[model samples]
Target: MLEVNHLRFSYGKNPVLRDIHFRAVSGEMVCILGPNGTGKSTLFKCMLGLLRGWDGKIALNGEDIRQMKPGERAKKMAYIPQAANPAFAYSVLDMVTMGTTAGLHGLRVPGKKERTIAEAALEKLGIGHLLERDYTSLSGGEQQLVLIARALAQGSNTLIMDEPTSSLDYGNQVRVELQLRKLTEEGYSIIQSMHNPEQAYLFADRVVGLRDGYVIADGSPKDILNEELIEKLYRISVRKVDAEDGKGRFFEVIY
Candidate 1:
């Protein structure tokens, strides 16, 4: 239930994003796929109301985001940025509990109810044991899961994740991707920026291919993740091999 229409943005005199359009429906995962420097993050920032100078309309369920207050927006969508090592050590429960305050207009404070919601959120992600652990001491995967738990606690069904698996190991990447899939199955709408075409192909129901800040292709992964598009997006010669496995056949890139 999110729509970004004809979005354009610039930094000083240099334009970074242009004519970007996309939408995410309930219970769907839409992947914005592009190489680095293709304005993927810029598009997300504009959609999230973080950078409001852009020249287009961002709407949530047909309501312009600009007219909605910060708390109102927080009630409808949750943004999960890339995880990094923390500078200051904070309790894991303390971190996730912050999400419960998203809808608090002012004087936001977590009480016993908020703490219980945060605990349930951690349990939803199957990381309940990490509630007392130091956030700075957890593994990269655990930290990422905690971040997702925090987003869950925000009580928003629509999630925007920027490069959700960028800094994780392969196993952790798989873990996060599977969690995202499960979220969609549970009727959460997700819009994620990803550079890995294979992951998008495997996980996303719809793929929006972006290059030079323009939408070059938008369709189902089976229709968009082809040899020509992959080669064009990466500027390299490649072939798509239909590989069959226990799960079924999928596109395998051959260079």
Candidate 2:
């Protein structure tokens, strides 16, 4: 459903993404795996149209993303940042309602119909009970789920997440992971950048390994990701204990 072709970008004289190429299809979860400075976020910014200049092409469902209007882009892709900082104490429903207003006009407030959309989005994520609660008062996991619901309310089935679980604890991280997997099962194309190789191996249907601004490998995790690549990516020695349901993949510091 999404494709990046020969994408290249830079910050002044320093190039961050070089000749990056990949594609993500419907009902699939693609993880861009790399450590710091590997151009994962840079590539995301480029795809999201936040960064431009000297790039080949990025298309969403056959339409060039660079040529898409802001409203059009909002309808095609939803970005979930690593963390959310809400300045106002908006209710959970209120926060999600904002997403439903992407195509709304000026001086317009969300009415009952919009509220219904927002509520259904939350319900899809199984958090409808928190509708009236304050957004900032929820736990990190709940807050993240709310963010995902907000993205859903925007009417986009494709999600681009920048380290979606980066700020949450282990339990919440697992919770979000399960939700992500579920979303993909429900036919949402999810492209996420993550530092945790284990998460990629366990959760992602396909892995795009980025290192030094280049795509070193791209394929199924079990095929492209192994002990050697794990060490190469993070410069650390951990184990990739193959087991069922991705439950046995774990990492520990070597003495």
Candidate 3:
């Protein structure tokens, strides 16, 4: 449901992204993989219209995003950052309900329907029990899930997440990955920038590898991810092992 073509961006005279092109459709999970300073986050901002004066075309559901107004874009795309730190002590439900504001206009407050939507979103992520808890009191993984719920409650078809599993422990990382798989099954298009290539191999329908702000590899994990590509992208040696269950593959850094 998303298409980016010839996306080129720069700050002053220095270019960040060059000739970037990719596509994601409904029910697909696409992972953008790269190391630091590869312009992954900058590319996301360009897609979200948070940055302008960039060259290229970004279309959502067949319409150019540049032509869409802020609210209009909000209705079609939702973003989930790493983890949110709330200024005040707000309940999980309160934070989630805020997503509904994208659908409402003027001074109208969230009512039963909005609350119901938020609650449903939390339940879908299997975190309904934390609904009444203080958002800041939860663990990093819980906080990330709540943010995903908030994005879902916004009623967007596409979700863009920046390092969704960045700081979580192993168990929490698995939890988030499972939820992401569930979202894809339920028809939410997902694009996430990830540091972990193993996570992409395990969950992503497609992986786009970037180096020096250019797409170096793009395809299904089994097709594009290998020892050579990994070394080229990260400047490190690694080994890939097939899963015993035959689901997919995983990688390990050779020391």
Candidate 4:
């Protein structure tokens, strides 16, 4: 349900993203993969309309994102950053309820039904116990889960996460990955930027590979995660092995 065409962005006189084009459909989990400084995150910001002065068009369906109001855009898409640190010592429930502002307008309060939905979102992420905890006091993983709960509370049709699993340990990474997979199965379009190709191959329906501000490959993970492409894009050797399921495989970089 998201489309980007000839998208371009720059910092000062230096260009960072060039002619990037891709489409993500409903019920699809798409991963944008790239090494450091390749502009994967910049592409996302452009799509979210957080950056201007860029050329080309980004739209949800046929409507231009630039034309939509901030609240309107928030209702259509939710963004989860690589990290979120709350300024105040807000309660977890209070932080998540902030997402409802798009639907609730200027007010920041959540009614009984909205609170129920927020609590359910927390429970889904397995962080129900943190509801009453101070956000700044929680651990990194806990805070990440709370931010995800906020995104879920936003209840947008599309979820755009930047390194959603970046900071967590291996186990917590798996937990969040599973939840993202479940979200896609339930009909939410998920677009995530990741540095981990293995996770991208394992969880993404399609992979969009970026190199030096341009899209190099966009296809099924199996097709896009091969040794040649990985080596060329990231300058690292990757090995692909047959997965037990037969329908998919596992990937790892060879040091």
Q: Compared with the true structure, what per-residue lDDT tens digits does model 2 show for residues 1-255?
A: 999989888899999888899999999999998889888888988888888795799999999987899888998899998778888899999999989888687888899989999999999999999999999899999999999999999999899999999888989998999999999999999999888877787899999988888888899987888877777788888765556665646666565
TM, every model: 0.94, 0.95, 0.97, 0.92
- Please give the CA lDDT of all the candidate structures: 0.87, 0.89, 0.94, 0.87
Kindly report which residue stretches of model 4 are placed more than 4 angstroms away from their true locations once superposed: 243-248, 251-255
Scored by Cα lDDT, where does model 2 land?
Answer: 0.89
For model 2, give the 10-residue run with minimal summed lDDT.
246-255
- Give the true-structure RMSD of model 1: 1.7
| lDDT, residue 242, candidate 3 | 83
Q: List, residue by residue over 1-255, the lDDT tens digit for candidate 3.
A: 899999999999999998899999999999999989999999999999999999989999899999999999998999999988889999999999999999999999999999999999999999999999999999999999999999999999899999999899989998998999999999999999999888898889999999998899999987998999889889999898788999878888899
Total backbone collisions, model 1 = 0
- Cα displacement (angstroms), candidate 4, residue 53, comes to 1.3
* TM-score result, candidate 4: 0.92
Query: What tens digits encode model 1's per-residue C-alpha lDDT throughout 69-147?
Result: 8888888899998985656798999999989998565676899999999999999888999999999989888899999
**Count of backbone clashes for each model?**
0, 0, 1, 0
Candidate 1: where is the Cα deviation over 4 Å?
A: 246-255
User: What C-alpha lDDT, on a 0 to 100 scale, does residue 210 get in candidate 1?
Assistant: 88
Query: Model 3 lDDT vs. the true structure?
Result: 0.94
